[model samples]
Target chain A: MGAGLTLRLRNELSEIRRLTAALDAFAEDEAIPSDVAMRMALVLDELLTNTIEYGYPDEVPGEIGIEAKRDGDMLMISVTDDARPFDPRKAPRPDLEQSVEDRRVGGLGLHLINTMADVDYARINGRNLVTLRLLVTSDGDGDPVAVAT
Target chain B: MSDAGNQVQATIGSEWVDDVLVLKPSGRVDSNNAGSAEAMILGQVDGGAQRIVLDMAELDYVSSAGLRVLLVTAKRLRQTGGRMALCQLRPNVHEVLEVSGFLAILTVCDGREAAIGEVTKT
Candidate 1:
C-alpha cells in the first residue's frame, strides 16, 4: 500500500459522480471485500451528499476532500470539509422502529454511518473532519484474514 | 469522453405489468439526480397508478438521497390509498434498505411476480 487516494471536491451535487468513482477505484486497488466495499461506497456517498446539501449555506462553494487508506485491518476514510462546524458524531439516531407515516429522513444518513463503521468527528480550524474506520477482510474477529485479489 | 464519467446517470424504465405499473431503475442515484428520479416515480402515482411495483433488478446503487425518493413515494402512495412493492433488489441495495428500516414499512419481495402480487392484493 502506497500513498492513499484523495479526492478534491466542491460542494456541488454533481461532485457525487467523482466521489463515487474515487471510492470505486480505492476499493478496487485495496482489494476490499465486495460487501464491505459496497457499504463503504454507500456510506461515503451519504457523507458527501449530506455535506453538499447542508454544509454550504448561501452558496459558499465549499471545498471538500476525502482520503481513503488501509490501516492494518481497517480501511480508514477521512472527509474534511471547509463548511460549517456541524459534527456528524453528535447527530442523533432516527427511530428505526417508526412506522411509515412517522418515519422522517432527518437523521438517517448519520444513523447509517454509525451502523457501518467506527466514526469520529472534530472541528479543526473551521473545517469539519469526519473519520470512519471500516473493517476489511475480518474473520468475525478483530484479526485480518487473507483475502485473494 | 472524459465528461461522461463526471455526469450522473440513472435509468427508470416504466412499463405496465397488468394494471400494475412497474418502474425499473438502473445505474446510480445520488444527490445530483435524486429530485428528477423522485418526479419520475411520483408521476405514476399522480396519474392514478393504484398499484406500483418497483422492479429493482437492475438498480445497482442508491444513496440516502435515492432512498429519500423511495421513502417519499412510499409515503405518497400510502396517503393516496395506493400500494407499492419492491423486488429484485441486489444484495447491497437490500442491505441499505434494511439498514434504513424500510423493509418494515415497504413491501419487499423476492421476485417481480411476488412484488406484483403484493401490491395488487386488496
Candidate 2:
C-alpha cells in the first residue's frame, strides 16, 4: 500500500476544504512536486463538488473517500463516493475551438483531468471509484521545479 | 479564533481604472469560493463597470471552478459588448488557462499595464 492515506468526508460540500489541506500534506510528506499537488487538489475538488451537488440532491449524508499512494515516480490517487452511478468519463468534451458565447459553463473538470493524468473509473459496491495516475517530476532533495512531466 | 487553515483566503479587491474595473483576487479560487467571487465580479457589472482586467499576480491557485467563473464573466461581458483581460498570471495559473484553451479566447497580457491597455482599447 506504500504507506497510503485515506481521507473520509461527509456529504457536506464544505468538507472539501479539509480534503485540500489533507492532500497538500500528503503530497508534502510523499515528496511530490508542489504544482502536481495543486493539480491533484483541483481534480479531487471537481470530483467531490460534482458528487455533492448532483449525487445528493436532497442534502442527505453520504460517504466519500480519497486514497493516495506513492508508486515510484507516479502518484496513485483514488476518490470513492457514494453518489449516483454516474460516469464522469461519459461526459461530453467541451470543444476548445468554440467561441465564448458558444462555450458551455461546465464540462471542463474531467477534460482538465484527462489532459494531466490517466484516470480509471469503476462502480463497485454502490460507490463510484475514480483513480488517477499522475507522473511527477522530482528535484532530488530540494524544492521541485513546478513543471509537469 | 480564525477559519484560517480550513479555508483558502480568497478575496477580491476592486479598483476602477477610469472605465475599466481592475479586480485583484488573491489566494486560491476553487469550488469553495468560485460562486461568491463570480457574484462579486458580476456585482461590479451591475454597478456600471463594463471593462474588467483580472490582475492575477497574487492568485496562487485556480481550478476549473475558477475557470468557469472567468468563462461566465467573459460570456456575460460579450453580451453587453464588454471585454475582459487577464494579466500577470503565475506559471501554474497560466498553464491552467492555456491547457483549458482560455488563452485563445481571453486577452492575456504580460503585465497589468498591457492588460489595462488591451481591455480599455477595444
Candidate 3:
C-alpha cells in the first residue's frame, strides 16, 4: 500500500493513520503478529512526524509518500519526503542513558524508529528516503522469515 | 495551525455511588488540543473532585502532548491526595499506554463501575 499527502500536521496524521491501517490489514491477511503490525505503524508515524516537523519546518509546501510491501518474510515500509536534503539515519542517536529531565525530547522519536525497525535512509535527487524493514515470524520461537515481494 | 485549535471533546457524567467525575473524550489529542483536555480535568479537580474517572472508551487517539497532560494531571492530583483512574481503553490507545510504560503508573480499570470503585476506595 502507498499514499502521498501534504505536510500539514492535522491532515498528515489522518493520512498516516489511513496508510497504516492499510498496512495493518495486509499484515493481518497474511497472518502477521499484531505486535509486528503495531511496531511497523509506529515506525511509519515517527518518520512521517519527523518529516512534517523538521523536513518542512519553515512551512514550505511539501509532500510525504509512504509505501509498504511484503518482501520475503519481511515487511518493508518506505517513507519519502521532499524538503531540504536531510537523512535521518545519519543523525546521531540520542543518549538513552541520560535521565528524562536531562535528555533532549526531540531525538527520542528517531531513536525509537532506529531501535524498533531495521531503519535505512538516503538522500536521492533532493528527496529523503527512509526504509524500515521488519522480519515477520510467529509470535514466539521461530526463525526470522522474509516474505516474498 | 495553532496548537490551541486541535479538536477535543469531553463528556462529563455524575456518578451516584460516588461523587467522582467521569470524563469521556473523543477525537484526537495533540499539542493543539491537549491544553483543553488538561484544563477540563484540572477544572474538575479544583471543583472538589477528589476522585476522578477517565473513560477512554471513546478516546480514539492521543499523542505525546496528550500523554503529557495525563502525566501532569496525575501528578497534581497525587500531590493533593486525590486519585485518578482510566477505564475502557480502546486497543490502540491501550497499546500506546503499555508501550510508554504508563500502564504501570496509571490506575486502569476494566469498566466504569470498577473505575469509580477504585477511585472512591483510594
Candidate 4:
C-alpha cells in the first residue's frame, strides 16, 4: 500500500459509507489507535456529509476528493469538493447547553467537526478544500496486521 | 444496522412493553439516515406512545445528527408529559453525548431495566 491514500466519490450522503470504509482500512494498515480511528471516521463523515447535502444549490452531482497520510503523531486528512464556498470555521458554535426544545438539529455536525479535529478551510480555483489534522498514536500492539488493497 | 466492511451496520429495533416503547439502534447514525430515525421515533411519540426508552447496548456509533434526534424526542415527550430514557451506550457514543453535554441533561442509565425504571419512575 502507498504511504498515503486518496479517494474520490460522488457528492451524495450515501457515499459517506465508502469514505468511512476507506478511512478505517487506512487506519488499520497504519496501526492507529481504535479511538483515533473512530474519531476520524466521525469527522470525515460529517465533513463529507456536509459537502454532499448542502454544498450544491442546484441538486446536481459533484465530485468530492479525500486524501490522508500519516505524519509522525498526526494524521492529516484533506477533502476537496466542487461545492459552493462555505467556511466551517466561521460557523457559529451550537449552544450545547440550551434546552432541548431550544436546540436546533442542523448545527451540531459542524460543531463536532470543529471540536474533534483541527480543521482549516480554503477556497481555491472554484473548489472548496477542507484540511483536518488529528493526533494519532499506535495502540502498541506488536502484531500489526496490515491489510492490502 | 451497519455501514461498510469496516463500519457498523445501522439498524433500529423496537419493542413495546406495557405502555413504553423501547428502541435499540445499532450501527452508525449520521446525516445520511438521522431524519428517518427522528421521524420514526417522533412518529411513535406523536401517535401517543407516552413512555419511551432507548436501549443503546448494541449502538456502535452516533454523530450529532443522532444526538439531535434524541434531544428532540426527549423534548417532545416532555411537552406532552411523556418520558424517555437511554441506556447501555457504547463508549464512543457515550463520549459524544458527554462532550455535547447531553449526558447531563438527558436520562441515561446503565441498562435496559434501569432505563425502563427511570422512564416509568413517575
Name the runs in model 4 displaced over 4 angstroms: A138-149, B1-10
Rate residue B94 of model 4 by lDDT.
76
For lDDT, candidate 2 versus 3, the one ahead is 2
- Tens digits of per-residue lDDT, candidate 4, A86-149, equal 9988889888787777776667778888988999999999998899999886433313347899
CAPRI docking class of candidate 1 = acceptable
lDDT tens per residue, model 4, B60-81: 7888778878888988887999
lDDT of 3 by residue, A1-149 (tens): 22322222232443555565666677666666766666666666767766665666563566777667776678877777776777767768755454323434445456556666888888888878887888876453112345799
Instruction: Go through the candidates in order and give each one's DockQ.
Output: 0.40, 0.46, 0.12, 0.37
Put down candidate 2 lDDT per residue, B27-57, tens digits, no spaces: 8898778878888888787777788999998
What does candidate 1's lDDT look like per residue over B1-122, in tens digits?
12223544457999998899999998877666777788788877898998999988888777787888998998898899989999988877888888889999889999999999898887
Which sections of candidate 3 miss by over 4 Å? A1-35, A84-115, A137-149, B1-17, B26-36, B46-48, B57-65, B88-92, B110-114
> In terms of TM-score, how similar is model 1 to the real structure?
0.90
TM-score of 3: 0.66
lDDT of all predictions: 0.82, 0.82, 0.67, 0.82
* lDDT: worst 10-residue window of model 3 chain B: B2-11
Order of the predicted models by TM-score, top scorer first: 1, 2, 4, 3
What does candidate 2's lDDT look like per residue over A3-97, in tens digits?
Answer: 77798998776788888888877887887776777677777877787888778758467889888888887888888888889777787888998
TM-score of chain B of 1: 0.90
Residue B21 miss distance in model 2 (angstroms): 1.3
